[model samples]
Target: MSFNNLKSSIGQALQGLSESVSQKTQEMASTWPAYAQVQQRLAQEKLGQITDISQMPREYIDLEDRIDNLQNSIQVLLHVTRVYEEPAYDWPYSTQESVQDWSRAIGSRVQELSRASSASEAGNLLKSPVGPENGPRTLNYALSQASLAVSTLTSSNMPGPNGEGLSSGLIAYSDTQAKLAQIRIAQDTQVQTKFNKQLREILNNPIAKANKYRKDVQYKRVLYDIARTNLQNARPEKEASLRVEMETLEDQFAQITEEATIVMQETLSNTHLLKNVAELAEIQKNYYKQSLELMNDLMPVFNTAKGDDEDFEIDAKKDPLAAKKVVDDDE
Candidate 1:
């Protein structure tokens, strides 16, 4: 760069630095008095001299308290509603492995067992390398497993009454339970998406924004009060400037207070809360209705089985000797 250009650039940089420092110094000077005044007010409050500090309008104070209560209620609701987001809350055990891992391990073990050459090798292979700990521990999963075991054990080429009724009933029960589990999962999803999600949006958005405005109003009120106090105690020579500062702070406080009031009013009047509550009620109603229907459908099968057992007991009582002979043969 040429010498003249370099000097001009340096002069411009220095001017900018000087302007920035002056701006910062002015800001600090303006802020320090307000900070001191706020501290003085707090000290007076602690000493039970609250009358010296300015009081907010009764309506504004009431609004603040109501907003606080609303926020606390929302927090409590969110805490409980979060459970709906976790569909596996009622699962019997924690999942230690993914489904794919369990499936792969079981498949590999079975394949190894199938290739065993001798009885000793087969026996060793028969020992499970992975336990049921890796499998889903949901009630539906347990029921399904039970159904599979019963079906496997009772399966036969020859048709007979032995084990047939029990296998059929158990399989049907498991199927019904599986359907109920699906419905429960659907309910949880709906609650999480439609109810809890909306609540969170309300709490995080309008409610939170209103609270922020409330804080801004509070800060501005403190500044206004401080400026007023300064103006009241000012010497004759400083009175005019102090009065001007107090008026400016008063206007700022009023504007922020108005904004905060509007925000709080809107937050309190929000219709989304009612909508979310209705959605939750609807989801729960559907869940219970479906569950009741499934249970009703399953009842007849078990009732018939119960009746058959009662008939056998009545027949046994009618022929006690024959019943004893059969029992002895079974033993």
Candidate 2:
């Protein structure tokens, strides 16, 4: 037999053994006093089998990899399952529905994370598993009552523009939805804070500073998508103002681009919160230069005006034609 056949055979045998042990443990937990000891012995035996199997040299590297991957997955599942694995337990009636629903949500999230992780592990499953085909059936157990969650927290209907009142369940659902939105915002803020810090450090090196400046500019383009989404979701109360905030952020991005031109200068080491502080420093240098030029140009005009005033007063005191002569000379 090929090594893949052997590994598959081994995997099948291990799976069967695991199920047998689990069944026996469940049965003995209620029927036998030494059930814990029995479970421990089974686990130790399985561990020994796994250790021995891993020591063998095999030609089917892919099969070996899959076997190892499945083993690790099984271990993780076992660890997760352990949380609910009390030897012999009875379900309480009062909070059973809530508990069931919470478990369903957790299971759904786990499945999502699992599929995502698996796709990442093997590179084939790029499409989101939550799409139309298998989504409703596979994810039904994890569904949440959004409207109910919202009403539960606020004890009031979320006001719509039409002035229609929603039920308590809907209010609970809305409350939960708002919480989720806030959580997403918090996560974004946390990520942006890290990016800002990293950009600060990157600005310490001139080349890195330039690279990060370009990166920051490029990355901010993503904000357009985010802004569009936010705009789509924005309620009538806040949509206009929210758009303005997004616009301001975009304007800041543009200002940063304009400032980036200053990085051509030699001194580029000192840095700050913006992505390209050295470039901003150059912007400041240019701003100062323009201000100096303006003053230089204005200074002569002011001085001449003042001098002309003095000459007018002297000419008025002595000869009127003297003031005209001064004006003609200036022209």
Candidate 3:
């Protein structure tokens, strides 16, 4: 062949290759990778609609329980404040026992109403049965009412020891308790969001997906080989088809391994991201420990040595100071 004809043929071949490459690039850019897209969409949906309270981290659940106990503590303190600080000389029931009894009855009434509401469907379940999804809203309403009632008492000052308002102690205690509850609720939400984000990331991780596909392809190759070997005795045509499938699996495994290797290398190269992940783990651990400690403190049985609920009760039979005097006499 002439040199000129050979050069022209080479030029045409190069141009055709270039055009084919361009077309393939355009198709790749325009079309979404179906598997990757579907996985990403699933992760997004998981992050967006993760409302199941049972799925909340243990630390967050502990914090919520602590907040509830703290609110109860505030209510008990409020009753103590009203009964002990304010003088009720003109009132019919003046003794500590009578006042405490009245306060206990009111508390029982509140509990009974709460229990009645909880027995209904709306109170029992939110969007799901196991989630306790509506608990926060119901509890919030109850807390708000109690806070408002305490605020009402503080709206007007009264004569008391050191010229303080009779309601001053209750007001301060309730306000602080409310603020604590609010902060804890906010923290619970933030932690839940963080958990969801982490879950989504893990579910959609490219490296993880690549490794999973690699394993699947490897397993398929083994089965395909067994199939081809079995068919070799009976059917050449079927065996040929099995060999083709096996070749496809081999190619897929090769591609997946290369992609996984690159992802792993890239991940290793990102020192800052690795450092941030480590730091996040440390922070999460410490925060969980602290939250658990706080929750343990809030439990009613925390101080078993302190005494039971009845320990604080004033004896009706003996003189009020008789027990203390016995201690004093022993001393």
Candidate 4:
């Protein structure tokens, strides 16, 4: 850069710095009196000596209290509802095996079984049962493992005449349970997206902005009060200027108080909160309704198995010798 340009740039920088300092000084000077007045007012309030202070409207005060209660309730809801954010809360346990390892293990086992010529050979190919130690610790996962184990044993001629039927029933049960687990996860996702997300937006945006306005109203109120006190105590020569200052402060305070009141009212009347709550209820309702339907569909299988067991028990009770003969033949 040329010398003249360099000097001009330096001069401009110095001017900007000087201007910034002056602006900051003015801001501090303007705020210091209000800060001092607020401290004095607080001291007097603590000492029970504040007699003629300005009071906020009763409606405004009531709205403020309601907003406070709403914020508190939202905080509590968020505390519990945060569990929806975690996909694994229902089945928190993790296996030591990676996804690839689990997949390969199952694939190799299936391949070995496919090559077996007979049920006896397939049974021999079957290894020890895989369980929660190698998979998620969920009821559906456990049921699936149980189904696999029963199928293995049934194929080996260990369970006898009813083996195939039992295996088929267990597989159906496990499949239905897996579907129910997916539905549950869907419900959690809906709650997180519709309910929890709305609550956080309300708390962070409108509620937060309203709270900031309330603080500004309070600061302006203190400044107004201090200006009024100064005006009252002013000498005759300074009375005119102090009265003007008092009125300006009063106007500023009133404006902010009105704005804060409007914000609080709007926050309280937010219909989105109602909609969010209804969404949560709807999510829960659908989850329960679907689960009930799935369970009811499997009820006949359970009842049939139970009825067969009951008939066998009744026959055993009616003729102990015949039951013993059957048992001996099976053995």
Candidate 5:
């Protein structure tokens, strides 16, 4: 039989024993009323019988064990568990639409700057401001024009172009140099010289010259940072152009550093290039355009002018004789 059926049978047998004991105790109390000792003894016997009935479940110990095993198996099944990891791209961890929007906006700004650079280079846009309000007007119009021009390119391609353009800022072109100079004047000079004088004075009261130098350096740091940011956000084609500009800037930086090193050789025996330590270091940098040009074309024009200049100088000493011969020949 099943464990449950066995347990039920034991319980029913115990109940029947209890009822029989109670009925016998009642009969003895009624029939042997006169004998107090007999009545007391019968009550004691009934108590023992009830205790035995309660303990009768122990007689079916194997059935109890079977019941326990069934219970344990059910508990084991309940204890078994399954776990799973939630998605990583859930609300708090996932990227937002705003991030993409800002990236696009920054890309658009870079495209605008590239167009402006191209327009200025092509002589389509005027270089200098015509009036006090002209700067903003020109900038806005140039940005609008750039948007119109770059509208053909899809949105997905924007980041790639931007990264490539920023890479190109490593190029050093003449136009980039001009723009960098302009950026310095427009952004750096005023803040360092006029705005931060009180701070400089507080920092070093007696060293006016040193204070001014520190302030200038700090200002340049800010301007270079902005330039680097602009280049980083620029488009790939523009980045290529920027690469040319970067080279030019590097050459200029090298020349300046060389001069500085010569001047401060005694004071700074190990003087290195300032551009290396300068803030937004990659921003004010450029690629070697002449080297690139040389790779593309090997012509006499690219030859060293030193020997030719020397030959010209030597021939210049015989100019009087040559001129006399020319006059005689003409006659």
Candidate 6:
């Protein structure tokens, strides 16, 4: 071919390729909003599964009950490690010794708070605000209620995220921060702060704190009485063995609870991230040009499809042709 002719052909080919790319780009731009919607919906659904932390879990309840059952029985061991109680009968005990070990256990939890982890832990806490066993309430309701609960504890020093109280204010992101910052705020600032503010105040109060001490003393006396009677009714070796078992169990519970709490904290943090990821998707949605006609809440309607066991099986008895398609009535 001549030089000019060849050059003209190449130019035409380039033009056609550019046009194809432009058309493909336009197609993607038109449909990308659906991508954002799916992301938002999935994130919201997962955030809904974030563990409810506001009312504590049944596992914690069971642990607390177990502790209560122990009472003053081993008040000496509450804060002490096995090192202190080793060799079984080594430690001295007295009814007058008294008991109140919540200080150490709760303090350990507080100390473990990695602002990042705790926020995530707390973020999932409000996933359910109605009864414990239900689908999620709205994110707005869960967060607003958390703010309100925190507000009840606001003081001049701890006036919440802003200097205003939690109930009266919202701790919103003015501008989206880095992922790490978001996690920190959710766990440490929001959830952990609220729990600590309430818990610490009670722990500090003279009268309120006294009640725990009183409860401890009462339980201790009962334990002391039991031990005394056991000395009379049972062998010294068996009584000693029982004390060893109780001490071991208490230590095990504390260790397990601590680890479990860390898992809960991480879940809570991720839950917050889940919601934020959804919200971020919504923000991205604004980037797309969605017409008024395209805007609707279709997710709820889509969830109505269901199947019973019978629905899975072929119902050929009702209609012979229902499950079978005859291309032609051949033979």
State TM-scores per candidate: 0.69, 0.18, 0.33, 0.67, 0.15, 0.18
Clashes of 2: 16
Query: Whole-model lDDT for model 5 versus the true structure?
Result: 0.38
Q: lDDT tens digits, residues 51-168, model 1?
A: 6666778888888888888778768888988987765667635354346557777887888888988989988777646743433345665576668666667655314554666667
Q: What would the per-residue lDDT of candidate 2 be over residues 22-62, giving only the tens digit for each residue? A: 99988977656433433444465567732221121232333
Candidate that scores best on TM-score: 1
Top model by lDDT, which number?
4
Name model 6 segments beyond 4 Å from true.
1-235, 273-277, 280-288, 293-331
Q: What C-alpha lDDT, on a 0 to 100 scale, does residue 130 get in candidate 5?
A: 25
| Clash numbers, per candidate | 0, 16, 0, 0, 30, 11
Scored against the true structure, residue 304 in model 1 reaches a CA lDDT of 53
lDDT of 4 at 275: 72
On residues 38-142, what C-alpha lDDT tens digit does candidate 6 reach at each position?
Answer: 454446545884222123357655544543443332333323322212221221331112122244544444554544366667555434232221211223233
Minimal lDDT window, size 10, model 6: 291-300
Error of 3 at 217 (Å): 1.3
Q: What's the residue-level lDDT of 102 in candidate 2?
A: 64
Give candidate 2 misplaced runs (Cα > 4 Å).
1-204, 264-331
Shift of residue 297 alpha carbon in model 6, Å: 23
Question: Candidate 5: where are CA atoms >4 Å away?
Answer: 1-206, 244-331
Report the Cα RMSD per candidate.
10.5, 35.9, 22.0, 11.0, 42.7, 40.0
Error of 6 at 305 (Å): 40
State which candidate, 5 or 6, has the greater lDDT: 6
